[model samples]
Target chain A: MPKLWNETIEEHRRAVRDTVLETTAELVAEQGLRGVTMSRIAERSGIGRATLYKYFPDVESIMAAWHERQIAGHLDELADLRGRSDTPGARLAAVLERYAFIQQQRHGHGAELSALLHRGGHAAHAEQHLRHFVRGLLAEGVQAGEVRDDVTPDELTGYCLHALAGAGELPSKAAVRRLVAVTLTGLRPQG
Target chain B: MPKLWNETIEEHRRAVRDTVLETTAELVAEQGLRGVTMSRIAERSGIGRATLYKYFPDVESIMAAWHERQIAGHLDELADLRGRSDTPGARLAAVLERYAFIQQQRHGHGAELSALLHRGGHAAHAEQHLRHFVRGLLAEGVQAGEVRDDVTPDELTGYCLHALAGAGELPSKAAVRRLVAVTLTGLRPQG
Candidate 1:
């Protein structure tokens, strides 16, 4: 095939793959994980059944890919926040607050949906990346004298993640903010 | 009926009910929740199916009752700890440590069992009771000048629960103690 023709085919394939993943997520959101099927996804995505199969083997695979994409997007956003901020404490606070907000929004997905999304390799990788991100920020904060030097960064990272996990159960954005503030207090230097 | 006969019947009924609950939990531990059935429970408890029906409507009801009993037992234990002679901070530390241990022990139950056990009215009631217990302790700590007065007792209670929740995932008892200490530091007055 000509170079232009090859590039066009690849771009078309990528667009179709993205559409299928998005359509699967929308269907799941509307009807739940159990209600989704390949035929339904293909019909909703405006793709042929054969073409859909070329992209994903089944609904589970499609959901897994969509979840992976979501985690990647979140990591990219966090990295963007890290790059924009100068002070370690400010960067840590920004990341923590954003993370708490993400957790709060996650509540709207419902427990069944969350259970479906929070399993397997992608979830584990996302967790490891999150811990590493927070640990690096804590190490910088300790050196800056803003966060406590007494505890190891790894321990502090665990404390932050565990405490912030409660944000998902909180009632409002304001409550999440208050939770983050309280968490930050625990990391402050002792007299 | 004669008084002696009636008392003996009542005693037998209590014994049978306790046996049924214990058998159900044991079966769930050995095989997952779906593996349990009325016949299995009756067989394991050494009771006939008809007699088992008199105690619980179904497996769901039996599990709910078992969870309720567990919560009540936990509350009684916590109340006992609260009654011991100590400063407010000391009482809080003892309670937090015990709670952390309980969370750690809960790990033996596994996530699927946890999901089954954490639903319904009993879990909500236990949560409310726990919050009230912690909030009361925080109020006492603030009055004693051991806990910070800047944040409301309710907020501190939330912070304590959130931070200490990490205990469930900690690798050892020492790590749980360290996490609790970090949480307490947040509740201390700023220098």
Candidate 2:
């Protein structure tokens, strides 16, 4: 192939990947990850099947790429929570609000990211991100003595998020804010 | 059909249902739920294609019935924390333990339920049952003054279970226990 033709192909491939990611997110959000088929995605994106497969080996890879994009976006939103305040309580509350806001997104992005992990095999990157997030939160709490020193940061943050995420009862913003409030007060060391 | 023959057929249906449940579960555990197919399930269970359909109209019905059985079993397990106790604190702790045990089983049962919820599409009943379970737990907690009376029982129990269910870290019994302990303590009413 000519050098110019090869360059065109690379640009086209990159475009296809972006389309696949966008289409996959929409389809998966609307129909869940199981509903996303390569043919369906290619058809929806107006791309050929061969081209789509050239970008993704299978549905799981498509979902995996989608997952990474999601994490990147969510982490960016969460970035503000980092260094929001010097104190543990201020940082904790800020992060909790961020977590709650992410959960409250309307397009079911949080739910789908979870379903993808549940549906597809566990991704090491996702797990590591969670561990990092939790470990960071608990480390701060422990150092400041705001949280129990006996417990690992992961254990504290892990279950706290576990509680927050699993809470289907907190259907609205008001409910979650209260949950975050309760969690913060409870986590403070007893006098 | 003769009455005697009808009785025999009914008995056989129960056996077929049990066989289908076991076969599907084994398939899920071995290859994950996505690997389960009608043809494979029947072949593994030594049942004919026609017979499998006769029992379950489609894969969803079979999965729904299996989930219904699991929900029934879980309800039976959680039936005691009601007015059976006067203090919400003790009762709430009991509810937490019950929930934690359920979390421990989630890797096994959770996978199947997750697959059904993710792929099966019979969401209404499953969600209703979840809401019902949490509402009942929170009502008991609130009435006993073990939980804050400000928030509705529905929200409290809903979030608590939601948190517990999401605690998939390590998927170990000890890990679930520790996570649940931290969460339940956080859920305790303020002094």
Over the stretch B8-111, how does candidate 1's per-residue lDDT look in tens digits?
99998888888888999899888888999999999999889998998999998888888888888887887799889489998988888788777777778788
TM-score of each: 0.86, 0.71
Best by DockQ: 1
Q: Model 2, range A69-157, lDDT digits (tens) per residue?
A: 77677776666667777787677778777776665663255554565554544455654676687578768888888787655676677
Model 2: colliding residue pairs: A162-B163, A163-B163, A166-B162, A166-B163, A167-B159, A167-B162
Q: How does model 2 score on DockQ? A: 0.42
Interface RMSD of each: 1.3, 2.1
Q: Give one digit per residue, the lDDT tens place, for model 1 in A66-157.
A: 98998899888888998888899999999999998887777778887777777768899999998999999999999999999877899999
Instruction: Show model 1 residue runs off by greater than 4 Å.
Output: A1-3, A34-40, A143-145, B1-7, B30-50, B57-61, B140-146
Clashing residue pairs for model 1: none
